[model samples]
Target: GKQITHNLKSRASEFIFYALALDESTDMAGTAQLAIFIKGVDVHKIKKKTETLAALYPLKDTTKLQDLLEAVT
Candidate 1:
């Protein structure tokens, strides 16, 4: 978490806007997924950052993900 925060803070200038999309099934055995969209930075960079961050710290809750989005933007 700290590492991710640090990386984001260091590259804060590259980001302009942040948006998060969350989806969850209505069934009891459904699953959830989150998609983060960031503007200003190049799409490739955003993709790389999101992929790396997802691998390092997989977020399970929307609140934590939102917190991260807020921090970066």
Candidate 2:
């Protein structure tokens, strides 16, 4: 993209990723996840990404994040 390709490439190189599964949803959905590998994903970036995704996909109620994770598993 004519966008921030440099920054994107730099960030992309920072961590390796592995596709976890094809799809986790019971019904047809495009939602998927990536198992972030490599190292150096320090707390700051983790917090930032968590907060970013949390804002993007806010949990409507207290469904226990761990349980939601279990559902995916």
Candidate 3:
């Protein structure tokens, strides 16, 4: 986990510009799951790349917009 995180950080640092995408969904157990993705253009190769930044699970009964913001920050 630590190594993967380090690699992600290293790759993200080389991005010329990046965009973030967030998706919220419910699982079979009715738990809210938030998926975060990063889409970036490589500075050196000018190639576009997309990667999963994180998957956040809210511990609350309902997953509110504020809850998602708080989990990310």
Q: Pick the candidate with the highest TM-score.
A: 3
Better candidate by TM-score, 1 or 2: 1
| lDDT (tens digit, per residue) of candidate 1 on 4-63 | 456555445455444333332223343233333333444446554432122123235454
Error of 2 at 13 (Å): 0.3
* lDDT (0 to 1) per candidate: 0.40, 0.31, 0.67
Q: List the residue pairs that clash in candidate 3.
A: none
Against the correct fold, how does model 2 do in TM-score?
A: 0.23
* Candidate with better lDDT, 2 vs 3: 3
TM agreement with the true structure for every prediction: 0.28, 0.23, 0.65
The model with the greatest lDDT is: 3
lDDT ranking of the models: 3, 1, 2
The alpha-carbon RMSD values of the candidates against the true structure, listed in the order shown, are 7.7, 12.3, 4.1
Cα lDDT, model 3, residue 29: 84
lDDT for each residue of candidate 2 in 1-73, tens digit (9 for 90 to 100): 2222343345445434311222222213443332222223434455332101111122223346553454334
Model 3: how far residue 34 lies from native, Å: 1.0
| Candidate 3 local lDDT, 1-73, one digit each (tens) | 3543454467678788876677888888888877666678878878656565644444456678777766665
Of models 1 and 2, which has the larger lDDT? Answer: 1
What is the lDDT, from 0 to 100, of the residue 60 in candidate 2? Answer: 28
Find the number of clashing residue pairs for candidate 3.
0
